[model samples]
Target: MGGGPDKEHVLITLFDPEPKDITGELRRRFPHFEVTYVQVSPSRKDAEKAGNEISDDLWKSATILITLFTLPAKPELVPK
Candidate 1:
């Protein structure tokens, strides 16, 4: 409970069909950091219907997060 500010949590999201590959890339890029991949299916009617509300929930819990996209020019998708 007293790890200090040096210990921070980072949340990352990928807006693409292949979350695994995106996550792997992140790991490679940031070898010293710990990464957790959240898989969300846009094709899922139930999830798509919920929209940003779900993303908002995840963003609230994240400390320092980054969203990696399949298309480099498509803009990095943040949790917000």
Candidate 2:
């Protein structure tokens, strides 16, 4: 909702094989919000295959992590 990661940071990973440009869509949908897409997979298949291989840096910066794929996330991987 704000201009930088300090106020709002969202990590989104889509699970659709042919994913839409969600970042672009979110920006369009919420033009007032300074939405940033961090480490989002290029495609649903890529996200699904990546599993919980998410990096520590990504988790550290993300205030909220939303995964479109139905994989079970490791508790340690979740942001506190």
Candidate 3:
């Protein structure tokens, strides 16, 4: 594999339709990023519930978030 960033990034993706193509490309470009994908229904309830189930450490460590409409159960779950 080709080299990438000096420091790894924590990237999280929440997409109703899923992001298989983009995730593959992202991994190719930035192999060092720790990427996690959680597929959820378009409904807000499902998205929020899925968000709540994720570990606090993951939410706290996330440096990038790619979300269509999903969000953490609480605003504070996101890192500052």
Candidate 4:
């Protein structure tokens, strides 16, 4: 799929493979936006490590990041 300015790149990291109906809700709310999912380990350390390991480009392009873990907003992930 081609992504343009109008496209919404949502990045969601969750411990469970199954989305708790959030995917449906997002799709329903923003029908035009493209949603993406990233599964991370339930362990806090593992999840944080995984998130930190993501390439800068990917993080920069994401429109919104939703994490199920307790990690605070990462400055690196959120572009200034």
Q: lDDT tens digits, residues 1-80, model 1?
A: 12135433456544555467866886787675456555444454434433343455444444565543311111233322
The residue pairs that clash in candidate 2, if any, are none
Clashes of 3: 0
Candidates 2 and 3, the one with greater lDDT: 3
Q: Can you list the residue pairs that collide in candidate 1? A: none
How high is the CA lDDT of each candidate model?
A: 0.47, 0.54, 0.65, 0.69
Clashes of each: 0, 0, 0, 0
| Prediction 3 global C-alpha lDDT | 0.65
Query: Model 2: what TM-score?
Result: 0.45
lDDT string for model 4 (1-80, tens) is 22465676777777889585989888889887767777778897686687776667667667777777723347755552
* Candidate 3 ranges beyond 4 A from true positions: 1-5, 8-10
Name the regions of candidate 1 deviating beyond 4 angstroms.
Answer: 1-8, 14-18, 41-61, 67-80
- Candidate 3, clashing residue pairs? none
